[model samples]
Target: MRSVAAVLVVLGAAGATGALAQTPAPASPVPALDERVVVTGTAAPVSAGAVGRTLAIVTADDLQRLPVASVTDALRLLPGVWVRQRGPFGSQTDISIRGASFGQTLVLIDGVRVNDPQTGHHNGDLPVALEDIARIELLAGAGSSLHGADAVGGVINIITRREASAPTARLAAGQYDLVQGAVAWRPATMGVFQGASASVDRSSGFAPARDFVHQQVRADFRFGRTTLAVSHLDKDFGAAGYYGPAPSQEWTTQTLVAARHQRPLTGAWSVTGDAWYRTHGDEFLYDPRVLGARANEHRTHVVGGGLRVGGRLSSSLRLTTGVEATGDWLRSWSLGDREEARVSGFGELEARVGRLLLYPSARVDAYTTFGSAFSPSLAVALPVRPRVKWRASVGKAFRVPTFTERFYTDPNHRANEALRPEQGWTADTGLDTYLGGTWVATVTGFVRRERDVIDWVRPDATVRWRTENIRDVRSHGFEAFARGQAGPLALGAQYTFTRVETDRLAGLSKYVDDYAPHGVGGDVSLALPWRLSTAARLEHRRPYGREAWTTVDLRVSRPIRRVTAFVEMANVGDAQYQEIRGVAMPGRWARAGITVK
Candidate 1:
């Protein structure tokens, strides 16, 4: 694997030199940024330009232009967001933001929370198909004031496509005996709009016990002011060295059903509500070929619902209030049967005074097991001049311990029932500027102080890993990015510097201190003649007390009539690195695919 990666890196460098030197003729003008309605940071759907918080938006067109296989792949391009994957193609993925742990981040699908109560490890196991995603909204910084628990770091919301213009199908094959197929359709019905999509992906092991199969299906219905959606995902993969150093195999399944409705009550008032149900199952074996070899099975179910009423209270003021309830239950042989319920109430006020916009929000959650908690936040945005803005925000957030951390028991690890919830306070400020009618630049600084942070630690190699509430941690970071488009070419670059201060403990830890202190990334895309296009991405990361690594990826595609063919080379520099310690990532690999619309 090391030799292959080294060779690919050399080839990639040479190819990049030639590609950068040759410039094609100017093709067309760059399109304006899409001003879509985003709902992740606020109580109601509002234009991204009107929000005061730090946010990033990824559109469907951007997904199509990039060589990405999953939502995790697309998120890595954004600033302040980290995606750690144990395997390729969305296998065992975890997301973090602004130096937060995996459990501190929250994920949602169309306003419905999907974070599993059993563990944060499965939070990225989304049921929605990739082709059905319309857009992704990433809200950085504290969001617990609006999203309740598990929103201490940030929020990632995946919005599904409500309508499709035409039927589309895609087929792909690649190294390691990979095969993938997907189909999507939107049908016109009487007084209703309907859509459906399905996909399947399978690959043989790149190494021993590394094979995987993934399947997904989605269906949607819309009429007047009501919408319904259903989705299911099943994944079974060889978990070679996924958990600890043992060769393991695992299977996971997820199902979700959701409904949403909206209606105008009067001239300035509207009512909105949504309800969803989700269930997940997992089966794990230390060794797939050996029967009864330290096997474990677990199942979890979550049901939640929310109702809200919001509208313009006056010409320059808006108000929104809502109530939410969630119930979670787990049935397992090792973790036992446990259930918990939570109810929350939240409200937000948005007022505009001259050139400054003010937003204040608060939420109170009552847990069946741990009493009540309150979160509050305030944000302000001011347009100092045309095409320039200044924003600042301060908030408090908290995360409840997962079931696995509190009750699970195994040979190598044991849970701690006395663990307490994690809490933190976060503040940030930033400036955004637009230059030359084509370029946009942003700079931001943030600080977070956390108390009673939960982590798994051990004193020595002979002892079991136990969960504990460690000491206070202070994290601070600075981030900057510049992006622009001119004629047929678009380019962007970003950098981040983060530092962590924590009281030293006696032994090794799982996730409290592992982070990339210095990171740099960039992307470039060009349009050529004959309906051809190319894109390249570069990423570099330096972890504290660890070796640094860099990687490069390139993609080229051409469209003819209704068909588009593309080729992608990933990890061209095949750097010897691991997102998760001890898990060996694949080296350089290539794939080809065709899509028809």
Candidate 2:
């Protein structure tokens, strides 16, 4: 009743001021990447075409046509990235890029790191609501030279939606007693340009022991040159066969408090700084099917901050330098208590020479336990022709062992206290072709050589899995995209191919061999008369040591005055697959919803 009342109130308000609503931009899964500004690959802002790196951008316009309960739904349509879910609505999802392990990818909100120190499994616990996102930037290769550590694979940076669009509310209900609701307000007449959003999702279950609930509340405030944000996320879900071959349940919560500032100092120089604090709590029930099974509780606290000062040294050159500090503490029922700290200083220079652009960066990090490490990167972008650009980049990246890998243990698992850190070098080259807004295409290839790769392994299933640093591992992949619009029909397609190799321990390891070797996905949208539209997504994947599967999702929406009605069907093909062995996936799940703006 509350959800309905909220929607009705929003509808009434929207109807009373329908004429004042701003129309959104055209929807496209693949925007003009050549002109978009990306900050994920580098610490500073740079045009995607000039970054000389593989960067993927999902704009606000793209989110309009997506059937997204969480950002993972939208991310699934993109190439070079993999999103594996044990349940729907982001109950528990593992995210990786270009065949990197889940722990290798770094997740950030407005440049604040959100990667949990407890385990990479909790890295996807984003506190910000999906409706509050303005854009998502993904850098597909090494990023540690700029982002510190745990960026061995890539980086994902989510930029929030701050511009006033409209006060909106949404309510949805669907399969398995699913229910969802969200509301956002960004008043045009505000004292300090404030925005707030709250959302929730609940599902009884597709099957027994598979129920889930997710809730989020966030607020943003901007005053002069400073911005502040606060957010909370709570999720409780059944984890049937997610961790092991047993029925289980997990509950997790996170709270984020962050602040950012940017100001002009003097002359052609400027300074920017940010600080953030986050707390996460988790309770995991291991195996309910087994008598005397145990449950573990964990509480984690993190604090991070950075200060950067930069300016235009010359018309052809730009310089930026910064220092960062981060610390994390974890208290666990079984793993005991532990803490770690790191401090780093970094610098970058962006220079232009004739038709060529150069980016060079370096960073040094001092760790409380592992001593010090150095990271460096260089990149170049060149305009080869009127409608073509060539780009390339080489960088060094690293990752430290998570507390779970180093200390956590149970009947089914054992920790290796003497675990070692992992480091890798990656290089990539790509070409972009564009012509106005009608058509755009991109092709990119990358390779990574890594050492001391970490993995949990056991000689046989009869023995408990143990954490070990495999001596050597290598990976290479390529991603391509072609997108265009003609008349009322818009089409976009992307494909990615990856291969991973491990020497000595080759092919026998338990989890490191599960990367997808081939993946292809695409989307099509058609505009119909009477403010109606339809969109469809088709994706195919072939896991390295697993079977291949394909799934298709479709959505249709119609606008009536100030309200929009939508129906979405996921896994329409009913593909039988699992992100992990023994896990179950939904088949042909459907939902219908209405949005008032």
The lDDT values for all models are 0.82, 0.82
Query: lDDT tens digits, residues 125-174, model 1?
Result: 98877788888888888899899888887889998887645899999899
Q: What RMSD, rounded to one decimal, does every model reach?
A: 9.5, 11.2
- Which ranges in model 1 have alpha carbons more than 4 Å from their true place? 1-34, 188-193, 435-439
Clashing pairs in 2: none
Assess candidate 2 and give its TM-score to the true structure.
0.92
Displacement of residue 476 (Cα, Å) in model 1 is 0.3
Colliding pairs, model 1: none
Runs of candidate 2 with Cα error greater than 4 angstroms are 1-33, 288-294, 484-487, 506-508
Candidate 2 C-alpha lDDT tens digits along 91-135: 877888888899999988888888898988888888877688888
